[model samples]
Target: MNDKKITKESLVQMPHEDLAALVFNLSTIIQTQNEEIANLKELYKLRTAERYSSSSEQVGYLFQELEILDAVLAGQPEVEETIEVAAHSRKKRKRANACTAPADTPVCDVFHTEGAEDTMTGKDGIVYKRVEDKTINKMAVIPRKMVVECHHYAQYKALDVEAGKDNKKINLPAKTDALGASPSLVASVVVSKFDDHLPLYRQTEIFRREGFFLSRQKLASWVITYYEEL
Candidate 1:
C-alpha cells in the first residue's frame, strides 16, 4: 500500500496479517530513526562538552553518562551504593642507578658534584669538606645538525711485479650512497613519520629548520624505498 494512502480507513480494510505486518514495519522504522537521532544527539553533546568543559568535568560527564546507559540497558533503577574510597597517595619512587644502554642507542651521563669551594667550618673551629651532592643524569642527545659520517677507506693499489695492469679498483666498502642516507637515519625518519604520526611535509619543514632542504617527496620516497626493501 502507498504510504500516502496509509490512512486509518485503508488500514482497517486491510487483512489481519497485512495490518500486523504494516504496523510491525512502521514500528521498526520508528525505532531505528529514534536510535539514530539519539546517537546524533549524544555525539553533539559529547563534542560540545569536550570543546567547552574542563578536562576533569568532561571526564566526569562521560563517566556519568556511561553509568546511566549501563543502568538503562540493565533495566535497573536502583540508586548506586556509595562506597568510601581510601585516599590514594602516590608513593615516592626510589632513584634508579645508571640505566643499561640499549642496542644502537647512545646514552650520556652528566654528573653534578659540589665544587672545591663548597666547604664548612666545624664546631671545633676546624674546616671540613662538606659532603657533596652528586647526581648522574642520563639523557639522549637530539642532534641539531644531521650527523653525516663519511667513511674513508685508504685505497691501496698493488702493481703486478712485471706486467702490471690495474686490478679493477677495489669496489669501495659497502655502498654508503645507496639511499643517500644511513640505515639508522632512514629508519628514524620512517618511525617518526609512521609511528610518531609526523607527516612528511612536517618532517621536511623540520629538516629545513635544521639547515637541510629535505623535500616532502624525498622523504616520501625514503619511506617507500624502505618499505619496498623490507
Candidate 2:
C-alpha cells in the first residue's frame, strides 16, 4: 500500500512491517508538534518583555525566531487518517430514502389479565380483591379500552377500595380519564434549546418573534433538564 493510502481497504492490504512504520512515524510527528508549541510559547514571552535598542535588532530577532520556528515545525510530520470514502457516502440516509409504516396496521388491544391493578398504584396505594375487570383508555381521538382481570385475593387493600366493590364480589373498576399534554412535548422543547445552543431567553424571544408565547422561566428549567439528561 502507498504510505498515504490508509483507507479500510488499503489498511487491510498493507504489510505488517509497513503499518508498524506508519504508526511510529505518526507518533513521532505528534511529539515533535507538541514540543514545537512549547518552544513558540517561550519565545513569545521572551520577545514581548524586551525593549529592543533598534528596529533592525527587533527585525533580526524576529527573523531568527521565525527560522527556528519553521525548522522545528518542518521537522514535524503531517498526520493523516485513512478515510473509507467509498463506504461513507453509501451509509448516510437521505430523507428521500425513508420508508413509511403501513397505514392499516393494528395497534390497540384489550386483554383480561388474572392480576390486580392495585399491584401497580392507586389514589391510596394498596391491593385486596379476588377479581376486578378494569378498562384502561388509550390517549387518542378514537380511544381503545384495555380490560384487565384481577387475580384471586388482590395484592393490596386499596384495589378493593378503588374498585368500589366488596373484597368477596368481583366487579369492574371505573377510572375517569382526563387528557393532559404529553411530557414528550416538553422534552422536545428542551432538546431544541440545549442541543441547538439556543439560550432559553433567546428561544423565548424567537417564540415571541414568531408570535408564540412561551415563558422564559419554563424554558430555562427545560433546557437545564435537557442537558442534565444528556
Candidate 3:
C-alpha cells in the first residue's frame, strides 16, 4: 500500500489497480465526513431545542371543560355568593374662561358712527343725540413689516466767495457707523435668536418670504456685533 497522498497527475500515471484503490478510499472518506457533519447538525438542533424550549406544560382544557370542572368539584359543596359594587358619581367639568388682555395694552378703537342720512329721527320731530358707544374687544396681531429709511442731506454752497464764508458742506452725523443699522432690526434679530431659539439661516428664510433677501452671513455678523457691544 502507498503511504503518500496521490494527486491528479500521479493518479494518471499510476497503475489501474492503484487508481481503483485511491478512488475507493477517497469515496469512503467523503462518505464518513458527510455522516459526521449530519450527526453534528442533528446534535446542534437537539441542544438548541433543549436550551430554549419552555418548561411549562401545554394547557389541556382551559378550566371551562366539563371534565376539569368535575375533577375540581369532586368533594366540594355547592354555595352561592353575591358581590355588590358601590355607585360612583362623576363631577361636572368646568369650561375654560376667556383670557383678558392687560390693562396697559394699547387699544385701537374702530369707530362705526352713524351717518347723517342713517341717523334716527323720533316721531315727535326730535333728533337723537349720541348717548353712548358700544365697544367690542378682539385680540389682534400686527405682523412684522420691513421698512427702508432714506436719508437725504441738504447741500449748501456759498454764493458770495468774496466774503469769509467758504464752500463748506455740513450734514447730520449718522447714529452709528453702520450703513443700515437700526435699533428695532437689531432687537428683532437678537430676540428671535435667543428668546425664540431661531437660527440665522431660518431667519434668512423668513426674511426671504417677506420679500427681504438678507443673507445668513450678514445676520450672523450683526448678531456678533450686537453681542460684543452689549
Candidate 4:
C-alpha cells in the first residue's frame, strides 16, 4: 500500500477500527504539513500588512497543536459530535441583551441529556431546553417603521410598514459608505464572517476581481466589532 496513494473512496471500504487508525495517522501528517504552509502564508501576510510581529510563529505552533488533536479524533464510527476547527462557532448568532422573560415566569421544567457547553450556557445550564424564545440577530436599517393609510373599500385599512429593515447589507470587499454607522456593528459583521467560515482576505481579491475595492483593514475592523458585540 506504500506505493499506492489513498483516496477518500477507498477509505470507506475499510473496517471501522482500520479506518479510524488510518485517519488519525493521516491527520497527524497533514497537521505537520500544514504548519509549514501556514508559516509561509503568514510570513507573506505580515510582510504585506506591515504588521509584522513575533506571534506569527506562535500562531503556527497553535495550528500544529490543533492539527494533532484533530487528527487523533479524525474518524470514529460512533463519534458523538462532529469536530470543527474555527476561531469561534457560527451558531452563536443570538444577542445576549435579548428581552428574556422574568426569572420566576415559568413553571414546566424538563431534564435532558448533557452535551456541549455552548448550547446550554446561552439559555440556562442545559444544552437543549423546552423554551421557545431565542435571540435574533438583525441588520440595522435606518428610518424606522411607520403606518401607511390605505384609502380603499368600505372599511378603513391601516398598514404598518417597516422602512429601515429594507436596508441593504454591505458585504466585505464591498465598500461601506462612510455613513456614521455604529463602528461596533461593522466589527460584528467582520467577526461573523470568520465564525461562519467566511474568509474575508480571499473574499477581498474575489470582490476586486469583480470591480470592488475592499480593504483588508475594513474587514478586520468588522471582525473586531463582531467579537466585541458577542
Q: Tell me, by TM-score, which candidate is best.
A: 1
Q: Candidate 4 overall Cα lDDT vs. reference?
A: 0.56
Task: List clashing residue pairs in candidate 1.
Answer: none
Local distance difference test scores for all models: 0.72, 0.59, 0.74, 0.56
What tens digits encode model 3's per-residue C-alpha lDDT throughout 1-230? Answer: 55886578987898999779877988998999999999999999999988887663454553467667767667454553444546854444333343678899998987777463535689999987666676888899999778887757666777778646667665645434353656678789889989998988999999999899989988877767766766
lDDT of 4 by residue, 1-230 (tens): 26678878887777899888887888998999999999999989979766655565466545677778766655423324434657643432333334556566544533343452433444455455345544543343354232333322233223445545554433333233332234544554455565655577765775577665667777676555544555
As a TM-score, model 3 comes out at 0.38
Q: In model 3, state the lDDT of residue 193.
A: 89
Cα RMSD of predicted structure 2: 32.3
Task: Report the lDDT tens digits of candidate 2 across residue range 82-141.
Answer: 445855633343343234556775568678774635446446876555445667755444
Sorted on lDDT, best first, the list reads 3, 1, 2, 4
Candidate with the greatest lDDT versus the true structure: 3
- List, in order, the clash count of every candidate structure: 0, 6, 0, 8
Cα RMSD (angstroms) for every candidate in the order listed: 12.9, 32.3, 22.4, 27.0
Supply the TM-score for candidate 4.
0.20
User: Using alpha carbons, what is the TM-score of model 2?
Assistant: 0.21
- Candidate 2, position 186, lDDT: 55
In model 3, the worst 10-residue window by lDDT is: 89-98
